[model samples]
Target: MAILKHIANKSADYGKVLDYMLFQHDDFTKKELLDDKGRKMLREEYYIDGMNCEAMLFDEECEMVNEQYHKNKRYDEIKSHHYILSFDPNDKEDHALTGEKAQALGLEFARNNFPGHQALVCTHTDGHNGSGNVHVHIVINSVRKLDVEKQDFMERECDSRAGFKHHLTNNYLRHLQQSVMDICQRENLYQVNLLSPAADKISEKEYWVNRQGQDKLNELNKQIEADGLTPSKTVFQTQKQSLREAIAEIASTATSLTDFQSGLLENYNISLIHKRGRYSYHLPDCEKNISERALGAHYGKDYLLQQFDKNTKGLEKENTQPEEPQKPISSSFPNEPDVSTIFNPSYDYGKDPIAILFVQTNLQLVVDLQNCVKAQQSEAYAQKVKISNLQQMAKTIAYVQEHEYGSQENLLESFEEVSAKLTDARKTLKETETSLRDINQQIHYTGQYLANKKVYIQMVKSKNKGKFRNEHSSEIALYEAAQKFLKAKNPDRQFPSIKDLKAEKEKLTIKRSAQKDTYNYFRDYQKELRTVCSNVDSILGISRIRQQEQEKSQDIS
Candidate 1:
């Protein structure tokens, strides 16, 4: 079981495919915090900034909220006002019932373990892998209502952001986690204390072995396949080559019956046999010889006839089947191995997939934010610098117009040069000021993008539900893979070198590029709009003043 939190501006619009992916179910509870109908959850609202709106809640956490409401009467009493808070219980294996239990546990812990003046709970389910590993979401109102605001170490940021008099502490979450563990202990639930050193050691060893073995096996198979063929070789080459070249050179090409047998025996330690009447040959010990599935690679009567037909028709093509395995990789490994002499009984394990996923997603969002902020800041700074230069030019032009002197014959020349310079300098300063204003608008839009990106990653992670790692080493590997697959210019054949593996990082460089570009364009558009609006205002003001003066002159006459 994993616990994750999301603070989204609009909960309904955040995640698109989360409810379906989590296999969440609909329920009509006494207190209906969430309803799962057609891939959407309607949120419960509380008083926030003196307005009634669907409270900002974490995704997939309806049931947990119900359970919490039952345990703590305080939650129900405080949630009378309108504010949005969301919670998601990430479960990926049919564990909604367990999620309910955990939710109950969370409520009891919050009520008895920690004291808060006002609180509310909302829970939803995250469907990962189409399995139900139920998660619980708890949203507590930061306001203490009538209680005295305590300015102490426990005060959290939500207090300031949401405009609450009193602050909330994360100790409430800690206590909830502890309470859930206690319930697990009492109810005999499968408890993997990932934080425990002993458990950590075992997990690391097992995960390493599994990953390394898979990699080595894939590498070996690829090597063998590559070695059997030349770079220029194709399916048609089987017909135009020498018999020996076809059989020995192209591993996929079968020549005489003896050649096939000899190649299999020498390379894979596999032997073939044919019955007295049967045309097809069978590998007697296929399980030991081939890494692929026995049935798929095994030559049957139909395959033999197919190949014969191809030969008779004067067409040549080799078998182009992918490799299979004897058993699933995950099923092949043992849970606990005998390592009494070699390993320690106590070693700390890294965080689980759920925790690691949140951390990575959140961290990536932060990185994107930093990049965005830097770009915006740079553009804004550049605009400021431009404005400064333009202002200097404008001042110089104005000074020249007022102070520079020339003879009556040369006055025309001085006026032409100085007046033109003044007009150009004024225009430059106006454009610079406009650019700066546009940059400011863009910064505001960028902030919105960053906020939305947080919601997007939260939803994406909830859908994945697994494949996250916590170890410094494992985290490095995970991020490197992401970089290769998502960010690399050519990922198919481009693998990061061993030396650079540790240094390589996954980033949303291209992804952020598009977002930043949009923001920047919008910003520029806004700046241009502002300048045009200002020009219009100035023209309107001038026209109004002239009209007023004409009326005054008529009245005076």
Candidate 2:
């Protein structure tokens, strides 16, 4: 059966979607090709010949469609619409269709469904990550001004009188699913009932998030295997799964909606946040709040209430039953301290760093200290780079301003310009700092990955391999993926030993330290710059206030 997923692009740049569909042959490297003009191009993919397309060139087709959309000044936030049509990877019947036939089918679906809209449809033999699923990408301009009619005999058995205010109407989506199912039936392909209620519906975003999470967890497990450590779920994974299961179980048994809410806090560390008529569940260890809708209909407010009513009715005589046994440890936060010890009480109102950055807080002081050190290190690197880049002439000019500019008695006129430059400088410095910090972060993760891989490799070579395989399958998968990536970049490259990995990490650390020192110097210079500019601004501000008063007096006289 074909699965359809919709993606709304707010960037309005259909060109990225075009690049994604046609030219992105590989994710890790840019796909370069010589166009008909013999010029090297990165974005353009030569549209395949004998493919059923309204236009021969993919880029030109998208541009033509989107250009017609710009005539309307109605600035909708959603700029482009992407529909992915995926067929079962194992189905030979689906596989038998040529790219041209698949493309033609996708085009017919798009043209009929999105009448009066410009669309680019392309058939692909594999999923983006090489998942081996045959799929078609239909990227359409949102504007609609033309009428479309369903194929005469293939017309939906439902009413045609109703007009749609939005493109994604429920009736239309149902119709589409039925239409696809019909095609599959006629073509004798494996089919799924798209119209049936999903057992547990997961949105596209959540699906990707879960997949990525699994990938990361698997990657970490690989390191554990290498380290010769007993592989298990990370502290984070254990907590998250524990919370989700606890909520589902608690919701299942609770006698009332209020009891369900209270029971969750009493038994588990989970907390519910209700805002704007939507419910979100949170836990101390959780990086982001998850909505009840995301959790599923079973945990939704209406379902909970309905269950509560049924439970209350069923338990008329046992209303005063004893509470179920809970774990000994306290679940919810009792109360926070008078002052946050991690951040200075005077600085930032002693805010919790966990709230600002979604790092594990249960590890407490060690994690907090590490974060502080990392931030300082990143800052120092940026400062050092700026200072090293400064010319001797600029340094001399800065020195002269520091020593003699204030005495000139005309610095106030330059205050605004200086302030503007200072603002721009700080912004640029921050961007540079972030870039350096990201590199350091990547290096840290890489070191961790390498360390774990070494340990895992040791186990894989011994009798312990089977035990490790059963325990850390995810980790092994991730390790294999990493190896493939490494090999792809350089087929001749061999996996480095633990010593080499550590040596590389140490070099990165040394570079970071030097950058930090330079960053510190530049930071000090920035502070000095701010001070000089602020002092002049203060004088100018006071003078302006006095002039405003003088103007009022002149107007009164």
Candidate 3:
């Protein structure tokens, strides 16, 4: 699988980004250092290329562009954007992914996505944790230096214009993720669906927090051991992890949302909040609530409800009567009908249509058994085979009737209908999800704009513009980004209020949740239908014959 990660660099010096990629740096402070050989240490194995600028003079070029544009002067202005495309560790062995090939792919990706921006495309053979994944590091100057043709991802006019800072909007990030997936697919390397949300979303920050916490906990445990006492806790749990485990445990057994909420509160001191069809949790001692999006897709309202429904169904099944024991095989076989008559399309049985359908499909199986050379010499074996087929035919009739299918055509048609519904539901869910994401982004930028509006106004009125900007560079950049985003989103310069955006986001989130339920329902229904169809095909020997015919046709071709 190829994983995409984005990091925005705030340092004014662009060389820091390139230096980190090319040289050995202190793990703690990330400062470049010399190797034991008293020389500048380089990465063990890497392939590096520059785009729209010379590799050695990338920082100088970027500085010149910034000077000309009068942008990126603030100390806190984002100087560059770093994107990492990490391939699966197994790809080296499985797909022969090399550093050179990765670097080439990175260059192509940079040229295509971040066109006209000075970029460093480098590929490293190994990662810091010693994972032997061939990963590409794409570092691009935040300020675009040249005018270029507009792309679909370019929303603002400034995006393709010279001296415009690059914007990493939610849509642009999604586009990059899709591009990575496409590249991996085209290269026939290991890939996963990058468009879908992960079941467990652990951000890079959270991962390191957990790791550091664990290390400290281990140290404490060692101290306790040295003092001749057992440590009460052997592991460290981040708040997200605790919330995830609590929710998962309760969702597995809770009968309803109310029950789930109550259980979490009572058992774990966790508060579940469902606001505007979105779920969030507040863990004890945490000042802020964590939304389901942060926890992951699995901890969301839709998935939890689906799990509840599954638990309900499982309980119902458990309460139902047990299946009856199988009947003994009789010694004699009933009068066997002519195989041709049984399978004749025009021949219609007045009742037991399922049984008739089963017999018609299984006719070849019974005939083959009866005509078998080995069976011909064993009377008991022949009798046993006949009895087994009879029992299977009876079960087939019962199974089809229980499912409310009147005939073979009805069963097949039902399966096809459910399959089609599942497909439609999935499409609808995806669209709803996309809309929800857009609304969320809108809400985010709008909030940022509102939060920094006062600071922006102060900066505009300040006597020393450069000094004020440097003092509040972070807020100014955020305000400008949000303002630009709003302008691009609303070309007419009329933007919705933050309240309106939130309302829209809430509405979309509700719709997405409902769509998810519909998708899950249809998906489960389709799975059951598929199982029935597969079992029927297996029992009738239809699948076997189809496979044989396909093989024969392939041979002929």
lDDT: worst 10-residue window of model 3? 357-366
Sorting all predicted structures by lDDT, with the top scorer first, yields: 3, 2, 1
RMSD after Cα superposition, model 1? 35.8
Name the better of 1 and 2 by lDDT: 2
- For 392-411, candidate 2 gives per-residue lDDT tens digits of 22332343233334332333
lDDT string for model 1 (447-541, tens) is 44344444445445664435322323344444444444433433474533433322221122333345454444434433432332232223223
Per-residue error for 5 in candidate 2, Å, reads 1.2
Q: Once superposed on the true structure, which residue ranges of model 2 sit more than 4 Å away at CA?
A: 11-13, 25-54, 61-77, 93-101, 144-175, 185-201, 234-243, 251-263, 272-280, 285-289, 301-557
For model 1, give the 10-residue run with minimal summed lDDT: 357-366
Estimate the TM-score for candidate 3: 0.57
- Which wins on TM-score, candidate 2 or candidate 3? 3
Cα RMSD (Å) per model? 35.8, 26.1, 19.9
Off by over 4 Å in 3: 33-40, 227-229, 323-557
Over 4 Å off in model 1, which ranges?
A: 1-103, 110-126, 146-176, 194-557
Full-model lDDT for every candidate:
0.35, 0.54, 0.79
Best by TM-score, which number? 3
- What root-mean-square deviation over C-alphas does model 2 reach? 26.1
Cα deviation at 411, candidate 3, in Å, is 42
